[model samples]
Target: MLQSVPDDGLLPVDTAQFRTAMGRFASGITIVTARVDDIDHAMTASAFTSVSLTPPLVLVCVEKIARFHDAILRAGKWGVSVLGASAVDVSTHLARRGRPLLGQLDSYPHYRGRTGAALLSDALAWLECRTWATYDGGDHTIVVGEVVALDVARSSEPALLYHEGSYRTVQETTDER
Candidate 1:
């Protein structure tokens, strides 16, 4: 039987507990990038998912306070590079707060997509998208995009996963079916 709780003008759980609970769900990591005014901005985001296949849509959530948030809004276009397990350093560097804005992508091999957004060269997959819509999501903005271009790597690589607040890699196993 399902039980219902009455509304009491209070959150069901505190932020820390909510975060811990959500952390238990494993998610793939990606580097979301945008270029505005000829300068590039990027953020490590796991809050991404495909929305539709018929339209080839995807969404990424960016904290309202992050600089990348504003840049993505202004650029109106962005790229997502689904990271492989070997790109932890790339993810960590991009996730750092207050990191230098200039020459940030210098260490990583990447190329500008058709939309002028940066895409990591060795990512498992690349997606270039144009902003389709935006919605308010409390502390974060939910940005949806219609994919304009995409590519997949020729070879398979272990996917980078985030769970329990740490980076993880998929373990290969024999097919049982």
Candidate 2:
């Protein structure tokens, strides 16, 4: 049964309930990075997806109040590092709020993308994108981008995933149909 809502049409569930419900959907994690004025800003995001294949489009949702949001808009470019299971520490560090502005990536092994965004050396894959559009998404902004460059690393590593409010990794099986 669905809960009744007021005339405002908003769902009756609170933010915590909504978040808890959404957490059931497992998703791969990625570190979205952008550079502005020689400083790198990054956020551990699971709200990322590929939108198109013809033009190679992808999008990442950023909280409106996050510093990376403004930095990405200003820079007009960004990088997405598809995290592997080994990069759990990298994700944890970047996911922390109120992290220092400078020297944030100093502890991690990274390299500069062609767009000057930082790409994690331990990533399973890398993507460099140019901002193509931005749309309002309640308290977040949906920033779509045209993938300019991308590569998949040559390694046999499981991908990091997020589900049920915790980090997880996938297991491979040999059940071939």
Candidate 3:
């Protein structure tokens, strides 16, 4: 799914500076999940994005060797659960690579989504997606999907964010557009 661009194609006038500046954009953390070998797999990701609205497309980047990468690819679907402030513990649980096997029934309080991926109940929003395509991006594989289901939260609680390699928070929302 690589869209080839000739060398003359320019990304930005200041790629390096923009990257450093974008690090200041603290977005919500999310857990992307899929099943592999009849076993559940999940990963903590901060690189989730809204791709489009017409078809409800979304994108999530998985590192080439991420434990959940191959599974998501194979499952041909995924669930994106946006962590709410109260769900930090669930986020921490899914993030542990050496974690003991947690049965689906008792795993982070979840319910099966439209695509059958576990959607955390505490998430501010959860979207079930059908795998659309996968493409290489250096050390990562970018996957795009069309949302098939949606769940939203009533409370707009503060969401956990990864910044400077650690979890942080925002106290106030900016009114500026």
Candidate 4:
């Protein structure tokens, strides 16, 4: 038997429910990358967004402690590769820390972007950018980038997604039976 507990600072929410709430807002997946020394540092992120099209600005929220965070800051540039449907495995590699950055490159393909960031091939879109600002936001840092260049590849593939702490694929064309 369980006893009643105080609300304290908790939001009266379970982790699963919280994740599900956020998951309802579907988003594209991306691997943010920068060069750290001779290595290409990268991490998977689903928090990428476009801030303004006029100034060609975009934002990616990264955990403050992520290894690639400092690298992106140091490089003053980053690459955002919007994952295509087939890149789910690639996303997993970047999402987890301690995995070599080049490990994903082995199976997938990539080339340096305009700012010398790694613009992975087969992505639906890629943005090579120089940072405009860094804002402190709780556990994550909001990095706004000044897009120096963008590459788009036409594909019928669906975008990958993060939902309920799991990777999911998008489905097109709904049918009622």
Tens-digit lDDT track for model 4 on 1-177?
355778787656698887789988877899898876767888888999999989999999988888777888899988999998788888987787777656556566888877777778889999989899999876788999999888788888888887767777877687898
Give me the runs in candidate 3 sitting further than 4 Å from their true place.
1-23, 100-107, 173-177
Q: Which pairs clash in the backbone of model 1?
A: none
Name the better of 1 and 2 by TM-score.
1
lDDT tens string, model 3, 69-159? 8889999988999987777677777777766655732746887787889888888899999998888877799999999889898867888
Please give the CA lDDT of all the candidate structures. Answer: 0.95, 0.94, 0.81, 0.84
Candidate achieving higher TM-score, 2 or 4: 2
Please report, as a residue range, the 10-residue window in candidate 1 with the lowest summed lDDT.
1-10
**Model 2: residues >4 Å from true position, as ranges?**
1-11, 174-177
Give all TM-scores, in the order shown.
0.92, 0.92, 0.79, 0.83
Q: Taking the tens digit of each residue's C-alpha lDDT, what string does model 1 give over 1-177?
A: 245777888756789989999999999999999998899999999999999998999999999999899999999999999999999999999999999999899999999999999999999999999999999987899999999999999867899999998999989789999
lDDT of 3 at 79: 92
In candidate 2, residue 167 scores what lDDT?
Answer: 91
Q: Candidate 4 local accuracy as lDDT?
A: 0.84
| Model 2 TM-score, all chains together | 0.92
Per-candidate count of clashing residue pairs (backbone under 3 Å): 0, 0, 0, 0
- Model 2 sits at a Cα RMSD from the real structure of 3.9
